[model samples]
Target: MGAKAYFAVAAAAISLSIVAATPAIAAPRAAENYVAMGDSYDSGVGTRTYDSSSGDCRRSPVAYAPLWAKANSPASFTFIACSGARTPDVQKQADQLTSSVSLISLSVGGNDVGFASVLTSCQLGSDQSCFDKVAEAVNQARTTLPAKLDATYSKIKSKAPSAKVVVFNYPRLFDLGTCGLGGLSKAKRERLNQAADTLSGIISGRVSAAGFRFADLRDRFNGHGICSSAEWLNGLSWPINESYHPNTNGHSQGYLAAFKAAIG
Candidate 1:
């Protein structure tokens, strides 16, 4: 072949090789039929942006579930989670699920063990009272919470058998650092964090046993707990209902990031 022809052939071959080396872009996936269910955490109580139509359910646009839906533009999004929801209440919420639900995210069991009450006691009562309250809550988490969670998970599975269920557990409320006066002491904070760990462990076990995905938030929220320099959780806010829950940043950065990772 002539030198020019030979050069042209080599260039063509190189072009072909480059094309072969490049990966094909995957087609975008179909929109999901998502259902958000559980308790205040799932409903975005701490964000303080609620849908009045939801009434006491307190579903918030800033919560992780809605945030995901808003960003992804899922085929359909249903928000049924309510404030103060226990495991049984979550089970009831699952009743709204159908076979069409392609995705589900849940955060529960905190209320089942009376965590709010425990936190209140820790805040308002004596040191011993705080210890006692945490211990009692931990006991319930280990003993009673497992079965209840199992039941709720089973119900979710039964309702939306094809859905990809992701169970999100709570974050450690405190960073075990010294805040000013009227703050929980390091000892009390340690016990509370331990209780959170116990609860996360129990929920993880149950989620695994039920063949669902478990999205642990403890690591994600590690440096952003209440006492941290950058806090993602509320600390005894004006509306007491917002206390001890993830703030807007927590929902967007912590919980939403974990949910996306879990689904991906």
Candidate 2:
């Protein structure tokens, strides 16, 4: 071949050699299988946007679980969490978890301890009544709630043995020092805050024992409780039942970040 032809052939051979040496770019990894199991907070009760197909569960598309799922694009996403779900309800949700599940996230024990009722009673009733309610809730949180949480956690582990479970704690609904907006008295708010702390401590400890990651939201919502200037939790709503649950902003800014960190 002539000089120019030989040069062209050599250049083509060099290009092919370089291409062979260069590693091919990898395709994005497939999303993990995620199942969300818990109560109203996990179900997104306070948010206006909801999955009506879920019926009474009120699983909202804007909920932290779905928000995480959407952002991460999980291969599979099952939102089995329900409103008013106690530990028993969580156990039932565990039935949906299978071996293929790779990720799990939830917030439980709130309803198990009658958190809503305590808040409502504290708001509408007298100080003594509020104190009594707080005492009862604290008792349940200490006594029955732990066992219930453990049982639920065990069931979860059994269902998805290899899954990375991320358990989220409920945020305190009161700013204590500032929480007098509704009928809840300052003293009652302080007691309720204590109740929340008691419940969260138990749940967080149990989460560790269960070999699951615990996402703490107590401090995350410090200045964003029901009493804050910019409350993340809804105080008293017209529907009434949705009171004190995290609002949409709470789910996005507060719970979503905690979940992503735990899962990652």
Candidate number of the best TM-score:
1
Q: Give per-residue lDDT, candidate 1, residue 73.
A: 85
In terms of lDDT, the poorest run of 10 residues in model 2 is 175-184
Q: Stretches of candidate 1 above 4 Å error?
A: 1-30
In the predicted model 1, the residue pairs found to clash are none
Instruction: Assess every candidate by TM-score.
Output: 0.90, 0.87
Please provide the root mean square deviation of candidate 2 (C-alpha atoms, Å).
5.7
Residue 31 accuracy (lDDT) in model 2: 53
Model 2 lDDT tens row, 162-243? 9999999878887655555354777877888888888889998999999999999987898998778888998878798678
**Backbone clash numbers for all candidates listed:** 0, 0
Root-mean-square deviation of each candidate, in angstroms?
3.3, 5.7
lDDT by residue (tens digit), candidate 1, 90-154: 88888899999899999999998999999999998888999999999999998999999989999
* Residue 71 CA displacement from its true place in model 1, Å: 0.7
Looking at candidate 2, what is the lDDT of residue 41? 91
